[model samples]
Target chain A: MARTAGSSGPRTEEAIRSAGLALIATHGYAAMSLRQLAAEVGIQQGSLYNYFRNKQEFLFDLIRTHMQDLHAALDAALAPEGGDPVERLTRFVEFHVAYHVERPQQVFICYSELRSLEPDNLAAVVAMRRDYERKLSDILDAGRAAGVFRLDDVRMATLAILAMLSGICTWYKPGGRLAKDAVREIFLGMVLALARGEVPAEAVEAAPPPALSRRNGVARAGAA
Target chain B: MARTAGSSGPRTEEAIRSAGLALIATHGYAAMSLRQLAAEVGIQQGSLYNYFRNKQEFLFDLIRTHMQDLHAALDAALAPEGGDPVERLTRFVEFHVAYHVERPQQVFICYSELRSLEPDNLAAVVAMRRDYERKLSDILDAGRAAGVFRLDDVRMATLAILAMLSGICTWYKPGGRLAKDAVREIFLGMVLALARGEVPAEAVEAAPPPALSRRNGVARAGAA
Candidate 1:
């Protein structure tokens, strides 16, 4: 009976966690309050205690939820094929962009505020983060094994790629100037050029863009 | 008498601004106060009013000082020395890495906290950032013109490179795992490989590194 109640409790916990995630993403964890979170969930402030112990606890649950969702989503998105690096990379890119666009709040909060968690929660978040990074590094190493990508420092390459792609969150909004599809296309194209095994010196053809502000890679949230 | 006072005043003002820059770089701008800034300068709190109108004015002045430093530094660093596009690109990378490593605190604060500025300050920062980016875009364009580099999209390419180098602050501690020179070499090599106009489709020679740590790239103040 206890196990059943505990398992079923996720419904209430999920709603509370979602509210916390959205608030923390926009305002940063330092500024969010439990009162506002409870209000957003349409529950009495006291009822929130059923899901989380305090603001810190609420944030912990949200970070954990974001991490678990990300891991599960990435696994679901990985292509069935094993050794093909480009295919694996392309799928990784697609999954990342989709996940970020679909759940911008979760991604943004997880990235920015997970460090503010309690000791145990911080440990858990750090572990989850290491797991994700290792997954990316594994993909790159596998590509090296399969002779698909080239790098002197695979660690730095992974970090660079991760940083560049994650930067999408900073400028990307739901109804931005560029369509999400175009943004993905442009980003994918740039990565492809970098990832290609042998781009001859003659192939560097960066053209002057129409205008910097209207840069096509600015992805809208829903369209892509 | 007026001329001497004016000259000394400019020097003293620069000293105060420099001192504030160092303080804000480590403590964060929001958490820091104008009172502390005045104390750091050996001036009474009221004297700060004479130098700048108010707290926001003083903060804006610090940001503008840093921005001017950055713009001029990058411009001087990337002057089109007579060389292959790869060489020019290497110079740019070296300058970016060297400066970031040397002034890790200033670079870190400037990148991360510029967002917290008021609307007017934020616009000024955005414009300065755009100016720096435009110079890089032009280099990529010129590289294309010279047929020394291959890129899919110029604007995205610029962002990718900037993000990659900007991320050095997250990992490159002045006293850390890799020495400054080694970090520069590794970073430059990977960037050159990307910029050299040949996509390195072949995998790297080493065993796969462990998965990367994703949380590393997420926050501004957690470089620890």
Candidate 2:
């Protein structure tokens, strides 16, 4: 939804989008006003309309763009379809944890403000999400069919794995106890173990892997 | 924070709370007003102050009450601590799934509106939440020590399992394709598998357990 101002317009649009995500991430969407968003972006309130039709459209655009970026990134990061499901699933976990840990604010608003979306916008974003979930579900089904993944319900397993991986955004901190890749590997191990329904005897007693240390406990439970 | 009121006063307070949770769950805490909540409860706006000092207090009360109830119910449902950690963890999973499934709205608001809490209130509620997490982490730690749960990090496992089970609120429905007990069992299987780091071989190809069926794919996704 760029306007005729060319380069400047896209720059301003990106600014508005970024500021809108921040504002909505901090304040509920119903409580965020276009006036405040404009101020944050250093643009006039009317300029926001040049980027999108209205506040609803603005929110929808942010979410839709995130979903689009997510799908595209998954396509880029996902391993080839014909590989072992265990390796494919491990790559999926690593990519998800890495992507989400970097975009905590977007992830936060995407979940918290879904209620604020109008029906049509909500439906569109939800469809994009299912497409993403379907990718992982397919991996799980492949693994289950090949006798590698042990699951009572493939659907339940898919949701459980997604939720478990998506949860990283709630607690992960940059330059903290665990680096990004370290976190990804640790989570990948857990996801693979969970998906396979096999907890190796040594995995239970596996010493905390190198590059991973005790995460400082934070009081942010339930935020995600 | 109850007031010295007659029996009707307690009933009115309960009504205000019920209506407040519904309003907040639908429209979010920031957008919910005392007047709107009072109207929903069929009480005059002025009467709301008799129960809560203001809107912030009302929001805080709703969250605090939910946390308190959760802790109490968990305490009531949790197996004795000295028992096998596997059994204890199993009981925790059963208790969590059963409790959250029945209170979808409360679960939603508690997570989604945590940002709306003022700093001091947020700290209080967060502490309570960490206390709850500690209970499960303690179980994971115990299991790890007993050589039953294979994990690279006790903290990571705790968060992953909690987020995984709590996620059922996003999709579970009453009288839906899966019965409550069936959902509980399926999730319990996953949680146990995750904790033990071993996938049950039979679970992979096991016939669909009684009362559970494949969930027809629905459009809802990424709303969480």
Candidate 3:
């Protein structure tokens, strides 16, 4: 109930959070034990209780903190409200790739271990995720309104763009063949192209426009 | 080592695999014990060993089988070897979405539980995955050679495309507002646009082309 009594309390809690993230990322939430986590943090098993009431709470805190930090960082990184949607989208892609590329473990745990969260915790995390998604969705909406982007379905595009950016976390290495800057630039080009609906004129002529019109209907109806 | 000794052997093995997928999907590979798996399957713990020698093997088999089936299905679904890259890319997208949509549990486990596989098993699975990526990568390469797809980096494009399509599994629900056909069409459109290097003319005109030339150089050197 009360904070662990000492100057070392916050430091120890930070250690526990780091250790828990690594353990859960490696073995998953259900497979990670409080005892194992405490051992990893070099603390007594009971001392974990001083930081969190139970494992669910601990897991929730880890993910919630990650989302909170992400949202805050995104807010700081984004182009200001009412700015050009292109600039905002560009900033979004750069921020997302840079943020995710540096924290692959966090991204991995946040996505993969989401199944381990309890119902309420899951709802909270899902809500946070939706809020995060809405930021990009809003950018797409603005781009569409400004006649700068031509997306068939903004929501689908949002999910696809987010997934594509986040997927970088799965394989990106700090000292890998491509530098972070190069990766970011390449992805930026792709994301901007995607947002702009840059399909070739010949391809557009080749395929029927029914999917576009239908998707527009669906998007307007808020069905997808 | 030997079969479970009856017509029921294959049936029971199928049951174990189903239950194992559900359990691992919900609780993860490490947290799923042989006892729990057997209990779920209404068999004795020892019976699991009749099929899988250990949990690691069980996990490995689950992912490996998924990859094998995916490859086989993909091979069947792809356009003929010398066909148009656009058509091949289209088929790849449809096949991927269809295959992965019906098997979210398999997709989740294949990505999440890779951490649970032993090193050798991991390598085998990784190789299988690389082979899958190559299917998509080769299509992009062929498109590039034909001057149909103007990708900055074929490898990056391949990963991005796969990540975007596979991401549908995370949020897609059967009987949801969007039909599978519609979702597939939308994704196909986006992937085609991406492969075609469809950035808006204005956006390209606005931004410096340094990234493009650099990426082209990198792509030519096979550096990315």
Candidate 4:
């Protein structure tokens, strides 16, 4: 549903969406303004209605478009023939790391700003997110059942893993020492380490009871 | 650093911080008005300034208090005497899960609203968070150096692990299917499983080198 700016049509639309994403990302959804967005796009305030009905509509479009784009990218990355489930899952984490790291602005909106959408739009975005989460849950479940991964309670497992991936957006700044793939590779290793389990010899001596230690990357500190 | 409001003083300060935390958590910092916070505390708008210099100051104080509280609780739980790094670290995870689950609003503010703090205040908060992270890192290092835990890179290891723990806040609701302690126990189990590097032997035929197996989670053409 892209409208082309015969001359600078796409440019204006892109500008509007980019400004909206940035504003919503830095300032929460409700705090974002049509006035601020228009100025950010170098357009008069009223002109915004030409492209979007209102701020809510603009946000809905932004959330929908960004989620669709992410879903497509992740699906492609995890194509059936990609590799084994473990490798594909690692690729998914890598993709998540790259998406959150490279497009921090978009990532923030997809997360914190989706709430700004009106009821109908919010439902749509929620459905999309649920669908995506289901993909992760299924992958984990299959791995668990097939003896590829050993996670208990796939639902919580998926949430924990995705949360860890989303966090890449919160802290990862590209220019810092680690490149995108470096973080991905190590995180992949960590995920696999958790999924596949750890050193067998060490397990014999000190493995805590299963009920006490189920999470992977986010290790807990002692009680405070 | 509390000044007495006589008998009313301590309670009023508590009311103000609690109100500020709740407002900032739901509506966001920009949208939370001082007048609203005062109303929430059953005081006149102007009286809030007595407890806090301004709205930002109120938010600043709330955040600082939360961080300090987390530090104190964590220190109390991880008292260096009871257990090995694994058990100590597991207790830490359980503590985080329980605390964050019980106080979802504060957890939301700690994760989301901190960005809105003025530079100086933000720096203070960041320093506290960094200190907390370092404490977790120290445990990991202690475990690894002692030949108990194995990890590729200590820094990456720490971030990935802690992110998983804090990540719980985003999804936890006060009353749901999982109880706080149950979830915490699961996290502890998941992590300790990883720490000892024990994959359930059934998952792989030949040990999957480095990583065990890729995710088998994608449920294509099943739900949509």
Candidate 5:
């Protein structure tokens, strides 16, 4: 008899990955056991080693694959070289929101389980994260250079924007009040506003905008 | 013989709370043992029962206390009644960034460990979070009514602003390249711009801004 897909090696590996993500996300890394993971995957305890060397490698593989796939998708989604910075940034916001909205589990573990990775593994994940961040930073820089975007600091804006967009995964539920496209549109507006440095007229007149403040180390009012 | 403050009941409770926070932050809620927690606080395992009935209650107490304190602090920090929405929003931004930056561990556990909370505890914490979110929502609503701020959906805007500010706790390090004051200011700009519906002139020209699209359910360009 021909072998079924479910019993095949690749299918088994995928099941292990999915089950591992669910376990780690629920019980966290320190609490999860290979024995439990094996049971969850319907594989013998010893056979689990055929998929990965150990739990640490399994975790590293999960995160690395997520990041790699993200980069590839982002590269494909981003606007072409020499494109308008506004266009590029717009694409970025749209792409980021759409991507993160669908992968809440992966997103949760990626942020929460970073501490579980070993030193070298942690370094690799952080480097990959930085590489991802630089993609947005470059767009912001280009926008600033072109005078299409006004930002006090490109690096800070990159982090802020990523945080703002990635945050949707925390609370967003499918069939919730807002659809994904609505979320994308609203976030896109906010991101563009941020890049363009648009403050309401009242806010602008009431005080010197923080972006315009020249004093380096002196604290702003109410900051204390 | 006089008793040391560290040995006093209140001090001991505080120590337990701190140690519990550290353990849960590192190992997550499910994995952390009460025995380990007691050891960390330098108390007998049975003594932990003196403070809380069980691990679940202990977790709830920590989160509820954090939420209560946040509410009290926010109430104190917000601008006076009938103040300008711009002013009120500014105060909210400043207060949130300052508050969350100091309590990364608490902020982290509040977000990451919500899954571990039992049904009632989770509902209670969620309600507290909603109450907190409404404070910001009211400010945004007032701003829109006064024509000082523009937003498509007040609730979504509230969540976005909170997410953006809370994100600082993840990456912010004291004595880092940017001071807390600088981060507060930069984030303030982004939040205000988001509220004001500020879009770059170039971005506005390149496409119909998402905020302006009249279509309710139809997908936007490139969203597919």
Candidate 6:
């Protein structure tokens, strides 16, 4: 949907979207004003409607576009279907870390601006997120069925993996401590560890049985 | 500092802090108005200053208080020093989950509002966060030294575990699909597994060694 009513229409629309992402990321969506956005985009305030209906619609579009791109990129990055589950998971981890590391602003806005969306838009975005989460959950389910993945709850495992991966955007810098490949390798190790069920040798040895440990003071401390 | 300048002083300050947190959390720090906060707390707009110096100061106070409370609660919940690293890690997961699950708004503001703080306040809050991260990293280092925790990078592992655990607040509801205890148990399992560094048997059998796998087609995909 390029706004190509005129020769400059597509360029202006692209500019508006870029500026809008930056503005809404730095300032919360509620604090952002149409006039300030137009100023940032170097367009007249009244002419902004040519790109989107209003601030609310603009936000909806930004978030929707991010989700769409994310799904498309994920599908392209995923290994062909019917591959081994462990290989599938490894590919998924690498893909997620690479995709999100470069787009911190989009990731931040998609999360922080959900509260600013109206009820219908909120429902739409939430559905898209569930679809994404389901992709990972489906992987875990398949692994469990094949007796390759060990998990008490597949849904919880799915959520934990996604959160750990997505959180990379919060702290990752382009020239920071770890290179991109290093991050991918380290995260893949953790994800595979999570999928496997082996407890550390020391932990296995010193840790009391769950039921007995609970009865002997660990329960009270845990409850607190 | 209790603002007990008069009988109603401390109560009013408490109301202002509580209302400000809700308003800032629902809207954002930049979008929340002092007048709205005063109205929510049922105080005269002009009298809002009895508690804090200005909006910036107020925002700083809200975040600083959250950090302080979190540190204090963690200290109180931790097991006695020199305990088994596995047990310490387990206790940390439980305590963090319980604390943040109930205070979603505070957690949201503490993370999302960091950008709105002035430079000095921002630096202070950031230092607090680093201190918090260091506590977990220290535990991981100790575990590694004891030959119990199997991680290549202690800092990365620490960040991953905290992010996964803190993420419980994003989706948890009082009576959702799983109870709090169940969530805690499942996460504990994941954390302990992460420390153990055990890959699945099937994965090990199907995958090549790290160096060879990187040279093979996996490296190309990872780079992309």
- Model 6: runs farther than 4 Å from truth? A1-7, A200-224, B1-7, B200-224
- Candidate with better lDDT, 1 vs 6: 6
TM-score of each: 0.72, 0.84, 0.86, 0.83, 0.86, 0.86
Q: Which stretches of candidate 5 lie over 4 Å from their true place?
A: A1-6, A31-36, A44-46, A200-224, B1-6, B200-224
Per-residue lDDT for A193 in model 2? 68
In the order shown, the candidates' DockQ scores are 0.14, 0.23, 0.34, 0.22, 0.26, 0.25
**What local distance difference test score does each model get?**
0.66, 0.76, 0.79, 0.71, 0.79, 0.78
Can you give the lDDT of residue A94 in candidate 1? 57
What lDDT, from 0 to 1, does candidate 2 have?
0.76
| lDDT tens readout by residue for model 1, B145-184 | 6665665456667877888788887667767767888777
Q: On residues A1-224, what C-alpha lDDT tens digit does candidate 1 reach at each position?
A: 12333445668677776677777776566656667877897666777787756777777877787789899978877646463676667567656865676676677777656446667888989899889888878878887787777655678778877777777776678676544554554454445445553432222233322221222221211111
- Docking level of model 1: incorrect
What TM-score, to 2 decimals, does candidate 5 have? 0.86
Better of 3 and 4 by TM-score: 3
Model 5: per-residue Cα lDDT over B1-224, one tens digit each: 44434577888899999998888877788778989998898778888887889899999899889999999999999737767888888888989998888888887788878887899999999999999999999999998777767666677788888888888888888889988777888888778888876453335346433332323432332322
Off by over 4 Å in 3: A1-7, A200-224, B1-7, B200-224
RMSD of each: 9.9, 10.2, 7.5, 8.1, 7.9, 8.3
Q: Residue by residue across B44-100, what tens digits does model 4's lDDT show?
A: 887787776777777787889899999998887676555677766766776778788
Flag clash pairs in model 6: none
Q: Ten consecutive residues with minimal summed lDDT in candidate 4 chain B?
A: B215-224
Q: TM-score (0 to 1) for chain A, all models? A: 0.77, 0.82, 0.84, 0.82, 0.84, 0.84
Tell me which of candidates 1 and 5 scores higher on DockQ: 5
Error of 2 at A12 (Å): 1.8
Please give the clash total of every predicted structure, in order. Answer: 18, 11, 1, 36, 1, 0
